[model samples]
Target: MAQRAERTERTERADAQRNREAVLAAADALFAASSSPHGVSMDDIAAAAGVGKGTLFRRFGDRSGLIAAVITSRLEPLRRTVREVQEATGSAPRQQVADLLDTALTFKIDNRNLMSAAEDAGISSPYQAQHYGWWHETLRTALDRVPGVHAPEFTAHALLAAIRADLVAHLLDERKMSPEELRSSLAAHLDNVLGAA
Candidate 1:
């Protein structure tokens, strides 16, 4: 009887893990497909995942927690790329800074809906995010390496603000600017900020 109970516990753990993955996957798909991620709700996710709403709350604590988990999962690859850029050999500081901002801009443009949802859920400031510090420090470090760049930290913050999710969304969605046009403008802006190379 004890052995049977142990087997049942193991099965339950496995099932819980599967449910968590299903929930994340469903949330990701729903958010990506939605024009407005704020329209997605915990109940929608639970239903899509074939799990109870209570189970979602039990696993993720709350809606914001679940959204954070989904964003973290989606950002893992981008984080890896950022790390690689940081560790790459022989790239000039200006070039590295440009690369970093460009990478972040592309990510913001791609995931603006998820980011907008995060903001609508009351996570209004990127500084409140765990990953924000890493991004800031990475860009600040690159800026520091550049000889003529003044105020590395502030410049880093300013550059990040330029590519912020809401700003990107506003430019693309509201202002009707093309992504290519946005990219070109960012490149030109970076040239002005970095100043010759």
Candidate 2:
């Protein structure tokens, strides 16, 4: 009887894990195919996930909530990377700053939909504050290594704003710059701005 109960528990856990994966995968595909975050419906997500409507709502609460869940999950790796960089690196501030910029840009490229979805969800005020706080702490820690630098907080904000999806998309779509060129320009611009401060 105990063995049977253990097997049942394992099966339930596996099913839950599969459901979570399906939801996120469906969300990614739906978001990518849409021009805007609002363009995708809950039904679209459900169909893509091979899930019932009840499952999605039961797991994610609402569309905005689903977006938040997806974004948070996708960002987990990025947050880990930044945290590792902060802990493991003994390099100069200039290199560390560049590393942070590169990582942020890479993340933006890979998770464009999550960024768009987050914006569309109207995550303002305290949400924005928490976001900035995380970036500022990352920036301040690295910026301390740069010679004769000040205002790490403001610099962090500038770096973040400059590397945002809208700006990068504008550069790619409107300006027609290649990814390599955009990255080069971004790194140069960041260094220039930090140098001035």
Candidate 3:
């Protein structure tokens, strides 16, 4: 009897994992195909994923929660890369700072829709989450190693704010800045921030 119950629990967990992946994939496709985040609805995601709407709610809580999950799923690879860079030895602090911000900026640019969905769902406050703190602390650590940067804590925050999701969307969607141009401009800005280091 106990073995049967254990098997049943394993099956349920497998089902849950499958459902979560299906939902994430559906959300990603829908967001990518839509011009705006507002166009995609929970019903749309549920239908595409072939899961009950209740399942999404149960697993992710609500619209913002679901969108956060989707965004987090997309961010995993970038996070892994950043972790490796953090763990790596002998990299210059200035280059580390640029690499971290550039990697983050590229993710925002590439996955603008995911971030847009977070904004549309009213989950756009970056500072409210541990994710934001992680970025800030990592950047501050690198900035601390640099010779000339003052107030590394505030410098980290300022640099992160510059590449924020809404700003990325505005620059790309409204002001018509190309990714290359934005990257170049950020590099120049970094040169100023790093101050000849």
Best by lDDT: 1
- Report the C-alpha lDDT of model 3 over 1-197, residue by residue, as the tens digit: 99999999999999999999999999999988877767899999999999999999999999999988887788787778888867875788888989888987897788777776776667756676556777788889988998888799999999988888778888988999999999888888888777765
What lDDT tens digits, residue by residue, belong to model 1 across residues 1-197?
Answer: 99999999999999999999999999999987888867789999999999999999999989988888888888899888778767866787788888888887888788888877776777546687866677798889989999998799999998888887778889999999999899889999988887866
Q: Stretches of candidate 2 above 4 Å error?
A: 1-13, 32-38, 125-133
> Over the stretch 25-111, how does candidate 2's per-residue lDDT look in tens digits?
889877766666567888988998988989999988888778777777777777887888778878777888888888878776666
| Per-residue lDDT of 166 in model 1 | 77
Q: What does the lDDT read for residue 146 in candidate 2?
A: 82
TM-score ranking from best to worst? 3, 1, 2
**What are the clashing pairs of model 3?**
none
Candidate 3 Cα outliers beyond 4 Å, as residue runs: none
Question: lDDT values of the candidates?
Answer: 0.86, 0.76, 0.85
Give candidate 2's error at residue 134 in angstroms.
Answer: 3.3
In TM-score terms, candidate 2 sits at 0.81
Q: Over all chains combined, what TM-score does candidate 1 have?
A: 0.91
Q: Cα RMSDs of all predictions?
A: 1.8, 2.9, 1.8
Question: How much is 90 displaced in model 2, in angstroms?
Answer: 2.6
